[model samples]
Target: MRDQVTSSDRVNYGAVIALVAISFMLLRKWIAGGVCKSRACLDGKTVVITGANTGIGMETAKDMARRGARVVMACRDLTRAENAAEYIRRSTGNGNVVIRHLNLASLYSVQEFVKEFIATEERLDILINNAGKIEFDDLFFDKRPYSPLLSYKQSKLANVLFSRELARRMKGTGVSSYCLHPGVIRTELIRHILVRFPVLKIILSLPCILLMKTPWQGAQTSIYCAVTEGLESKSGCYFSDCAEKDPAPEGKDDEVARRLWEESAGLVGLNPRR
Candidate 1:
């Protein structure tokens, strides 16, 4: 009886180990599924990526810098931005990586960054609106609390609107605007949320750890949009997994994009006519 019990315990442990291994294999396959694989270089082009102090944004900056582009890491955190820039420069041997302050939550900060960028840089080849927020019960400037889902969705919608409006306004310019879904990357973006809800964090921790894309993998679609040759003509199109994908029905509404552009301009104190 003792021997049979020991044998049963060994079998159970082996089965558990086998299950874990299979799970990891599946997760690895998923994470490694989509890749850009483009070797296009940026030579003299200038690229700006917002929220580039960490995660997919930083990875995108590093990839662009490796292709010989002048990369501006627009971030709200100066210290982290500088550190990321330095890392990119050293990793890519491209010393042209610079950091600029950009606080996407504040309209004033957005306008200020644009002013400085336009004044200093002679050309803007690529502008990537990569930053996003996922907040819960956030109060807008109107002092009314918005549902977390709506607040986050609106923030992402702004990225699409900004890209479309920028493409329209810069029609004749050499600049191109691209917005991408960087995949479900494992980044620090959810640290605060996880800290706030420990039980939820525990539930999500294993799957998130196994299945989510690393920052570099997540940035592939953005890098693809930025460096792909023919994509210059496909401005304002949404991209995912290194390919153009149809956005939601609302995202495709040009009228909404235009209206949002005007409203955004007003908020940022920019001339709508410009």
Candidate 2:
């Protein structure tokens, strides 16, 4: 004889499952700190994080601040950045958090952000390129016609190109440029996909949670790149979870990277003095 689930029993079980799911998601949102053995290492150091208003960027900023680094939250929206800074300040009790406006989509904004950063600070210890977008339109899935995925791919490509250019310019300036892929964390960046394609989102998200890392897990790579002792020699390399990542077929195109660098500077109306 086996026990059977009645309608009421099924309803109760469903509610319990929903509750468990919400609890798990909430737990993932509670970001944690990193293990920095020496406080003397990070004192007075400065870090700039693009897309620091949310997701792994926020977690990274918080962890860095907790370790006593002066962290700048560079974002496109000033108000949102301020709010992120406030939350970080409250959460970590570190008042060194500052918000600077930066919009990666626009070369002009990128130049302005860099200019303002250089104007206010002399040396930059770490620059983390962590902003990205994904296209989930139906046409993109159809794969049979024109889609807008090209724009999103271009944006991600620009991030790496920008990092490479920054590394070249900062070669002797004691600044290190690092870029990372923050594995699949659910943030506003992915909210559009979830809203538009709920079924696909659920399928993709399940695998991501099982095979993916949390925002902090993703942030750890940048943390290691920023603070590790031997990263000076690894400046231009891309990282994923603190390990060197092979550039994608496109990312490895030196000609493309060079063109992107020059074009971006031109787009921002900045003359490359070198």
Cα RMSD to the true fold for all candidates: 4.9, 7.8
Question: Against the true structure, whose lDDT is highest?
Answer: 1
lDDT of 1: 0.74
Candidate 2 lDDT, tens digit per residue, 79-179? 88898999999999999999876657766776567666554424343433333332223313455455445556656766776677677777877766776
User: Alpha-carbon error at 232 in model 2, in Å?
Assistant: 1.1
The per-model lDDT (C-alpha) reads 0.74, 0.68
Q: Score every model by TM-score.
A: 0.78, 0.68
Quote model 1's TM-score: 0.78
Give the Cα error of residue 149 in candidate 2, in Å: 2.7
Candidate 1, residues 190-255, lDDT tens digits: the string is 787789999999899888887788888888887777667767778777787777777766666677
Model 2, residue pairs in steric clash = none
